[model samples]
Target: MEQAQMPGCYRHPGVETGVRCTRCERPICHACMVDAAVGFQCPECVRDGSGTGHSRTANQPRTIAGGRITAGHPHLVTQVLIGLNLLIFLLGRLNPALIDETVLIGFAFDPDLGRVVGVADGEWYRLVTSMFLHQEVWHIAGNMLLLWLLGGTLEEELGRVRYLTLYLLSGLAGSAFTYLIAAENQGSLGASGAIYGLLGATVVLVRRLNRDMRPIMALVVINLVITFAWDGIAWEAHIGGLIAGVILAYAMVNGPRERRALLQGAACALVLGLTLATVVLRTAALT
Candidate 1:
């Protein structure tokens, strides 16, 4: 009988084999054979192909320092949130009429201004809803760009649920703060508050991770300065959102023993209180 053609292991040479390595298509012996998704491959090839390594034991779930589960893409949640915000902003822009006084009054955060005007009136719900709305293309683009750049690292470190909670809570805090600080009968709209919240969360993460935050801090300061210095910018909303974000971030990073869950709960509760107080104050001042 003729000897089977030996092509040698595809990944590692000189080792003669009768069967091919499934990954790299080299011949190998039974000892080097590995069962895989496509077909059998040499152990060396399988290790590289599977990306799990040759000595991969049973599928053991790994836990991080905070007992958070790691997934294939840790930053997916942040991406989705930013995507949704952009989609809403774009959809709102498609028809200029769609983004009217009614829409803005109903959805955007206003300090009971419409109510004082005795026109259609402003709803308290706008505070939370306003975080999802953006006025201009540039506005949405800038916000999403920052989210893409900064949100990934935060989501990876904090996990999806926690990261989302932080983002939303920060937005609420910002909106609430703006309502509280805004002159009664004034209207404000945009996702700048929520974006500022993300920045606040970034500050907390930098401190916790013990990394240099000089660059980020400088960026935040510059942005704040620009917001105040620029025209047509709602500096109040930015300040409010930033304050809320810092508080929410601090709670998330350094809360009690059950820090993650506790901080999340506290953030929600705090937002509710702030919202209610802002509404009451605005209504009283407006009326």
Candidate 2:
């Protein structure tokens, strides 16, 4: 059998690479890559910047994090994510059995199904599904409210792609941390981790834009206080998501010129790797 042909850099046809110009969609090796307005661009594409909707040139609109500016609906991703979570919550309400199958649990037996079910049982998707599922009205209400308030700002500043990345990764980090710390039979669910991630990112952004810090600072303190003081709160998930968000946001906001994409990508990979590692370790311990 022959191996599949690798994509060669457009500029240097002999050089193989998987990276592509975000604008023209041509393969580009690291040396031929240029971080354009939103992401990497090939030299040819960058030369045509004024003609296209992308580029570092002033003709194009961009966010603080260099994502394409969608002026008409800056909060589009935020709205969709909020709506999806609400939809899932409603579905769970309509079919209560769905909640048991999807809730984040380290490891547990389902007597109704007469089988083991959980992350440790290889149902890893629960980490993602649980974040969008809430049983009680108050639980969903609180999470959706915070997401609406905080996510719009993030989606506006970071653009849709980056904002969504931060949200989902934050939630997964929270689930992984909770899995490691909570009892094997214990089930925890919420969007708290993702919410706290956005909250932490807001602080970094406020500082970046030189906005007044008092209002947001007060809010962070209050949430942290609640995370600790409130009963049934999965404080571990909150802390994990907060830490991941701060690191990821710093990369998205402060990533240096000439290598923003590379650094930001690295940061995202690091957070994801850490989350996966935590899950693997915890699962091993449980089994």
Candidate 3:
């Protein structure tokens, strides 16, 4: 039982394997190889074999992890966040009373500058919790739809865990800002803050990748306009989220090489600290 010797570049034989497809495990020649996010794939197998059995090659581009990866795929974190938001929306619809009693409890902003300066009470969890709650059907729909559009691509670009961290932190930032500015109000809910964060991340990444961002810029401006024009919109949350996103993107995605991961990790930490501080002040003020 001896393994067959691979050809000079083939690495696999008996089937005239020219080069290996990086994505799917198929033998292909230089002529048939298709470049992929992490590596090269055999065009024939990718096209003919239902797109399975992919393997990475050294010649393909590698991330900091030293492997080929996929982009724009929905990572588990994004899926879970989306599911949670939808579930909450459905439950709210089913039990109108639940929505009413819990609306403020679950998603309202509470500012406590006194607490920040050691004078009042606060509820720190609101920074993160507020991200999960939404007020109206259209609110959730718009947020979730934007999340579906931008989150998957971001998760793929940054990998699952990092992407999740960025998203949560951005949401928290949005919530905290709302609390700080609107502490006198009952509270606020929606994914717009987080969605704005995604937009911020996109703008940074697009610039880093050297891709034209005219389209993304246009989209962002349109959303901003809508946010300001619509009385129902939480423009504060959007701005906070956008700021957090830009910071995270700058930290996570500003390098010629594999620095995106490092920047992203740093951004996540910064967001966590800032949002937690806001939450603690708010909670202490409340109590």
Candidate 4:
């Protein structure tokens, strides 16, 4: 007796799969399988309906990452993020202490709070909170405006879940990078890191779609110049977020149709793990 090799997906030739599309009997990987009334169907069968009098499958409308296509305010996640940032900023204004407590720092002695506080001191929440903190109107304004412009399209294109994951992980990666290299007492807070991540993601998306690339490329170059030229800007966060976003967006958009979700999830996990490791190493160095 001889063993037969598993067949690959019709659309993705690289994924080894044992399942076949019920409609056309073509092999399909999980990424390309669309649920049907009878059984799973391939994307082509799901799209055309093949004059079989079958209604369009409920699972037909999917994003580039296989996320469900949301109707009516597809950018809901983006809207919520902006709203939350604004609300936090307002709170910080009302209670200036909130800014002191939340701003990103590896380690710092807070004279007002009369205590040593920082990520190394176990206030790790700062990594996330700092992304939403802004003392200056100009800082928040610039960030929110960029988020509105870039986030809406990216959210719609990548769908809510992937877009949110990319945003958060990018922000965390930025915070981790800042903690790893920036002076322990150095204070940094802003959404610029996350926005830069979106900027990098936009570049990847534009490239994937084969659209004109000059505008996005120019935007990135200009921001890089600003990141380095400016005195207070955290260049570490910007570079870290940009790199994480590029890696994640590439995985999200171009993961092979065979086990694509698994691959993308692994990429996300890799970023998170590396970021966590970096933070831990820095914490040890500080202590």
The number of the candidate with the highest TM-score is 4
Cα-based lDDT at residue 225, candidate 4:
96
**Per-residue accuracy of model 2 over 138-232 as CA lDDT, tens digit each:** 98898889899899888877879999999989988999999999999888888999998999899988887656789999999998998999998
Candidate 2 CA-lDDT value: 0.83
lDDT of 3 by residue, 3-115 (tens): 88554323212224446665556565433355655556653444444343443322343332222334344466788889999998788778754443333232233243222
**Candidate numbers sorted by lDDT from highest down:** 4, 2, 3, 1
Q: Kindly report which residue stretches of model 2 are placed more than 4 angstroms away from their true locations once superposed.
A: 1-59
lDDT of 4 by residue, 183-284 (tens): 999999999889989999999888866567899999899989999998899999999999999999988888676676988899899999999999889999
lDDT of 4 at 105: 92
- For model 1, how does the per-residue alpha-carbon lDDT over 92-211 read when each residue is reduced to its tens digit? 778543344323232233343333331124455666667778787787788888888878877765666667776776676666666666654455677777778778878876776556
> Cα lDDT of model 1 overall?
0.63
| CA lDDT of every candidate | 0.63, 0.83, 0.64, 0.86
Q: Assess the local accuracy of residue 244 in candidate 2 as a C-alpha lDDT between 0 and 100.
A: 87
Candidate order by TM-score, decreasing, is 4, 2, 1, 3
Inter-residue clash pairs, candidate 2: none
Estimate candidate 3's alpha-carbon lDDT, on a 0 to 1 scale: 0.64
TM-score of each: 0.67, 0.79, 0.67, 0.82
- For model 4, the superposed segments whose C-alpha errors exceed 4 Å read 1-53, 56-60
Q: Which is the better candidate, 2 or 3, if ranked by lDDT?
A: 2
